[model samples]
Target: MTRILAAALSSALLLASASAETLKDTLPHISVTGEASEEALPDRAILHLDIVADRLTATEAVTENERKTRSLSDGLVRQGVPIDDIRVVGVTLQSVATEEAAPRGAHGKHVSRGFRARSELSVTVNSLDEAASLLSRAIDAGSNDLRGVEFVVSDERTRLERLRIAAVKDAEQRARNYVEAVGAKLGRIIEIDHQEAVSATEANGRTEPLASASGVAFLRLRPGVRRLTARVSATWALSR
Candidate 1:
């Protein structure tokens, strides 16, 4: 019985290996990667603000924080910012000593600032020219921390499609370069896969990891130029 079982296992292994060999590509092929990018001025500005309050008691801190948020919202509404455009994405309360209240290295050992309340605010401001002024106004309306503004394109679907096409063309060119160098001909593409899309605000293509094709990344998007980068991996048959 043991010998019979061993024979069956050996046969199964041989059959599986044969199946894998049959599926393996025997044709000569080349694999290459391509990348491309395009830049445009961001069309929208999203402001990030933090309203924070510290007091002897948690209730007092929370109440003060709430008042500041209301003041900020009302001020923006008065400046023609729509109510729907202002959002409070997060809120938190904690007992800790902040750096501003401490003197250098004194982290929380001897200094206590009491309970702190914070509200994270996200505001959409459409006018680029008004961004600087909006920050000033937000401060006066009770924002304690200016986290910075995110500039984005309202719609990027059309632009991203262009980047992808360019990336594929770039891959083909690279494949051709190698084939021509070797005195060979480039044949039809066997497989193509979209690898990555980096939507960055700056030139370095570093910042946030974009979500699929539309994820957000912070790059050098300085005031005028934002970059959208795409990459593709592809395989092509080598023509004889």
Candidate 2:
């Protein structure tokens, strides 16, 4: 009985392998790579602000940082911005020397004069028209450190779907062109592999710094357009 079962399993494996080989031999397919891209004006802006302060004690430094952050958030809200859009991204505390440390001693030890605390704020502006005004308000409220703004598209998923359709059409067109050139006719599609879409933001311009009489400084930014790309690879059967 054992020998019979072993023989039956071996026969089944052989038959399966033979079937796979036959299928491969009968179906000849051609593979092609296709790509499509679309561009849309950025409808959103992400700005990073840092509230940094240094004090003799860590607690004092952190307190000052928090106070400034609160002011900034309140200012953003007053500007008709949504409360959910303003968030604290990160907080950091570091010991920093007020002046350059003296030359290394025999013990190889350095002294820090005070602790610097930094609170990072992230604000997403949905309305590009209000970006400049909001930025100025945040700075005036108490945001001491300013980082550049990033422009992005809000309706990215819709654009991506459109690109997918374009990509499939592009593949079909190319396949047809190839088959015609080779004196063959394109048959039904046997396989399709959709590649992940690649997207990038093209910052058309930078923000110019604005200084006010109250020692508030911020950048006036322009939300530029971004480009999105989709790629696909397809395999179709060929015939004479």
Candidate 1 residue-pair clash tally? 9
TM-score of each: 0.67, 0.76
Model 1 lDDT tens row, 1-240: 999999999999788666544433776788889888877777778888999998889999999999989988999998888999999999999997644456677754446679999999999978764555566668767899977778777666677788888999999999999999998888866667775464555633223222224442222224546677778888778887
lDDT for each candidate structure: 0.77, 0.79
Over the stretch 1-240, how does candidate 2's per-residue lDDT look in tens digits?
999999999999788667645654689767888889877777788888888989999999999888888887888888877899898989999998645445666343466789999988899998766787787777767888777787778888888888888898999899999889989888877656676554445445567777767776756676555678888887778899
Off-target runs (Cα >4 Å) in candidate 2 are 1-26, 98-109, 195-204, 209-219
Residue 5 displacement in candidate 1 (angstroms): 40
Q: Find the candidate with the highest lDDT and give its number.
A: 2
- Worst ten in a row by lDDT for model 2: 196-205
Clashes within 3 Å, all models in order: 9, 0
